[model samples]
Every structure is written in structure tokens, then in C-alpha cells.
Target: MPEIGAPHKVTHQDGGNDEISLTGLSGLAGESQTPLAHKTSHQDGGTDEISVGGLAGRQIFVPYNAKIADINEADTNKHTLNLETALSETRKIIALIAMTSRVSGSSVFWVYPNEGTTGIDLVATLRYGSTLIIKDATQRLQYSQGFANDDWDLYCFGYVVEI
Candidate 1:
């Protein structure tokens, strides 16, 4: 009887919601020792959705007080990525890659921050070479570009939860 906008299916019972597909998976969760993050429990009725495309590439480890936002250099283009640590509480975006060793077909999207100015409605268009991953139901991955100058070095691994 449902089917309004569709796209909602979460089945669980085997270890119940241990973070491994509730919908949105591009394919990848290769190895695990329990650290995929995205554990929700409702038990009987339903409402336990998990995303970040099933940990994309896997490696969800964040907890050492986490406070490291980086971009090595060369942000040439219509650049827009600034996160020198601004997640004092919402942590779980495992890892956002692209350190640029050789591949430079750069492309990234997702933005929401204004005061220093930033916002024109553009979201989630990542997934390029050099393994760009994001997991643990994701937290925040602020970025924006349109490909004009081409030069990047991004890094936004996360962990800052205590509440």
C-alpha cells in the first residue's frame, strides 16, 4: 500500500542492523571486523535506514578525539572546501579521499554554509578515482567545484562525538 516516492527497504534479523545495506549501495563492504557504523534498531515496525552507500570502500574508524580537516595544496578551480575541524558533535563520515598522486579528473559536490558565503544548491556527486569514500551514515562532507582549473588534494576523515 505504500509507494509514494519509493526507495525504502530495510530488512534485519541477523545481528540486526550492523550497518551493511539498508538501501543505497554502490557495492563494497569487502572486509569487516565490525566498524561499518550505521546501527539503528526499531525491531518490529520499521524505520532503520542507513546510507553513505554502504561504506563505499570500507574503513570506518573514528575516535581519538578527531579534529583534522585537510587539503594539502593546489585548490585551483572554482574551489570550495573548508573544514578545518567543525564537527564538535556530529561525527561519522568515515573518510573522504582524493589526495592526488596522479589522477586529476577532479569532481566533488556537497555544500551548505553561508556567512563567509556558500550555497547555490548542489549536493552529492562524488565518486572518482583515488578512492573517495564516505561511511558510518556520513556526517558532513562540504565541497563544491565545477571543473575549471583542476588541482586538488582533499581529506575529511571524521570523529567528534560526545553527547
Candidate 2:
């Protein structure tokens, strides 16, 4: 039987550029939100249909042809989201983030409310081994009692990449 989650395309021949592909080897030059629900819904070309909530629970009918900016960065945070530069430059906005932790045999994730300030209740995304973990970026994780920290690093609240 074939293994689950197979790669779309597996290439063995090195692309010739060592820096281009980072398969392994650590210590190497490598590496690499939300709120204000902007309700969006659409009648498929009739293939995909989804109903999303708008800011403060407002209902909006989004059509298939219309791609809405559901997450209003300006309203997401109490402070202003100076996205004019990014918006003008045309960037994908990645708002909030989520965080997660892994245990002996299971994983845990968390999500927080996005209220603008980079203080508390943020979200984050973490990657461990083969697991993609997402959790509350700023909220104190309620895990093992000893693992909790009061001074959690505040994950900057904003869209990293324009959506």
C-alpha cells in the first residue's frame, strides 16, 4: 500500500543550485489574526460555497465573483493599521497567528481574540517536526501548570502578508 500524504512531485536530481533547495542540514542560512469578521458568502460557480461573519456579527452576502476583504485590519486592532504602503505596494496580508505545543503522543493548539494591540490575545503558528501547530499567540497557554509563563512574548499584531 502507498504511504499516506505523498508528495505531489518527487524530484531526485538536484536542481544544481545547492542554495535553492534546503532539504536538511541545520545551522544553515535558512529559515523562514483576525477579528472583525467581514462576513462573506457566495453561491458557487456552484462549486464552492461558504458563509463568513462580518465585523461585529454583521451579515453580508458575498457573491462568487466578489472576493471580499473580510478582515478589516483597521478595526481589528484599537490602533490604526497603517497598511496604505503595503496596500499600495500590493502585498498579501497575513493578519493573526496561532501557536501550539506537542506532547508525548499528541499536539495542542490555541487561538486568541484579535483586539488590535500587540499586547495580549494574539494568535501564532508553529511548526514542529511534521506537525503544523497553531495557537493563541499572546494568551497564556493553559498547559502543564509548570509550563505557564506570565511574560509571554507578544506576537506583533498585523498582516505580515497581504491577503
Candidate 3:
């Protein structure tokens, strides 16, 4: 369970079913790849190229859209996250990250929209400085209807891991 007032990484795999461990923190998610954005050093130490990686000391903003209606009896979008196995079609993006103390776990979580539903919106933003392993364009690890078939959009920003 996520600590009150603390942001937690919610893990969802397999499908919208078969929930797994609700406790324990692990390592980062996704496969390792070349740094998408990295910081460069200068000789005079004046200014340098800055790269962004996973959530370690960086902030990532991912926008998306989901035409889902709020539910009454466990029908709210919150239920979409209840599925530990995988997020539902409603969840457009899943922000995966490395193990950290803030969330007490290593996994992926939902990035909800801050404004009205059914339009382009900022899904989630990762606030950490770690190497971005990989990002998925699909909706969680389930029998997704596919991007071409669904009404969702993915905006991922991969930064270089600050050494």
C-alpha cells in the first residue's frame, strides 16, 4: 500500500486481472537503452548539455486522453488502477520507474489527467533522476485494443541518467 501523501508506483502486469504483491519495493522497470537525453560537460564548467533519464532527480510529463466516465459503485477511474496486473484501456499511460524510498516500490503507475476528460492532457510526470529504461506506447500489460483501435495518445520524454 502507498503511504499517505506519498506518491507510489503501482504495478500492473499480465492483464487487467491476476493482481500480485501489494507490498515490497523492487528495481527499475523497462529495458536499458541508450540515454535519450544526457547532460554534457564543459571545459570552463560554465554551461553543458543536460540529459534526462528516468525518475531520479528529473521531472517527466506525459500527456494522454481517455474517454471514460466516472463510476458510482467502484466504477470510478480509480478502479482502473486497482488492477495490479495491468491498467485498463482507460489508463492511457503508465509511468514506470526505478526503486526509490519515496514510493517504497519499483514498478509502473497511472498518470491521471488534471483537467476534464476526453481530450489531450498531461497524463503523469516522473520526478526523479534515473536512467529511462524504456517506455511503452500501449496501455499496460494486457490484451489492449491497440493504439490504432483506441482513443489514446502517449507523450514520453526520455532524459539521460545524471551520473
Best by lDDT, which number?
1
By TM-score, who's the top model here? 1
Model 2, 74-159: lDDT tens digits are: 12213222332313324333242323233322212222234321233222334311111112232221221112222222222222
Error of 3 at 42 (Å): 2.7
**TM-score of candidate 3 to 2 decimals:** 0.19
The per-candidate count of clashes, in order, stands at: 0, 26, 23
The per-prediction CA RMSD against the true structure, in angstroms, equals: 23.4, 27.4, 30.3
Report the lDDT of model 2 for residue 143.
Answer: 20
Cα lDDT, model 2, residue 100: 26
Number of the candidate with higher TM-score, 1 or 2: 1
Order the numbered candidates by lDDT, best leading. Answer: 1, 3, 2
lDDT of 3 by residue, 44-161 (tens): 3435644344345443443323322221221113222222222232333434322111212222233332221332112233333222222234332111111222233222232222
Question: Quick one: RMSD of model 1?
Answer: 23.4
Question: Candidate 2: how many backbone clashes?
Answer: 26
Q: What is the C-alpha lDDT of each candidate?
A: 0.38, 0.28, 0.29
Q: lDDT: which is higher, 1 or 3?
A: 1
